[model samples]
Target: MHLHKINKVLICILLTYTVQYLMLPFPDLSAEEGVIFENPYKKTEKQTDVTQFTIYFTKKSHLIPKQDQVRLQSVADFLYRNRNFEILISAHSVEGKTNKENVLISEKRSLEVERFLLIHSVEPNQIRRLFYGNSKSPNLTKEHEALNRRVEILLQPIG
Candidate 1:
């Protein structure tokens, strides 16, 4: 009987040691081991230098240019890393277009950008969309109107 109890005690001790040995390679839950996730698109510098990014569109078109897509991707990466931040999209259209046409175009532009962000994992609640169709510009030159037809992205803290 005494020998049987000793054997049982030895078995429990050996099992405990084996489990601890197997778990030694992994990090503790509380350990600080840099970023938990690896983001290939992460930027080296802090984004504090710029809180806003813009995507320009061609005359009467809402299609996002390829270069702007890359820029927006960078912004998406930033937003992914910082969950507390929210995005504000201000969409504008060319001033010379009819008010109704500009409204539709501006809405399409904002929705397109919002969809991009949503597809990249941003929550719908974190986005606010605003459209200023045919909003008068200080300079009505073609170049200035071109600038006006864009989606302006602003990142700000939620709280």
Candidate 2:
């Protein structure tokens, strides 16, 4: 096949896979009345976001967008219900700052997220935090700098 035809075939395959993955029901852990689940992937009538997600922040800003408030509430609810699950929240900031200032910005972002979770009744012990300032961020162009300024959330079931 010609190089162009091969490229088109590769792109088609990737797009098809992406669509299928998105359409399928996510492995949501639905809780009812304080019951502990054996399998998190079990499907249910009412699904909540029990998976990992990101909270993005604007450049040099620690505030979360108003639109993401609802989503964070859902996460808070999930963590409150599943006491055996633990969440790691790592706050990050964009490059081009002194280490002291970078850490300060990330710290503010962490506090904001932790406060939200606490207000929603999530147990303080169920949460873990890390501050990764511009130190961990890779060198990137102007357009990609926004990607580095974010708070990444990860979830795992505790023993």
- Model number with the top TM-score: 2
- In candidate 2, the residue pairs with backbone N, CA or C atoms under 3 Å apart (3 or more residues apart, or in different chains) clash, namely none
Model 1 agreement with the true structure over 1-159: per-residue lDDT tens digits: 999999999999999999998788754655442222222223223223236866667777888877567677777787888889888999888653488888888999999988998899888877889987867444456645656777888999987
RMSD of each: 14.4, 15.2
- For the record, the alpha-carbon RMSD of candidate 1 to the native fold, in angstroms, is 14.4
Candidate 2 local distance difference test against the native = 0.75
Residue pairs whose backbone atoms clash in candidate 1: none
User: How well does candidate 2 score on lDDT at residue 136?
Assistant: 76
Of candidate 2, the 10-residue stretch with the lowest lDDT total is 36-45
Q: After superposition, how far is residue 1 of candidate 1 from its true place, in Å?
A: 96
Query: In model 2, which regions exceed 4 Å deviation?
Result: 1-50
lDDT per model vs. reference = 0.74, 0.75
Tens digit per residue, CA lDDT, model 2, 1-159: 599999999999999999997777764644473232322333222324447766667778888777467778878888888999877889888653687888888888988988888999989998899997877776455666766777888878875
**For each candidate, what TM-score against the reference?**
0.64, 0.65
RMSD from true fold, candidate 2: 15.2
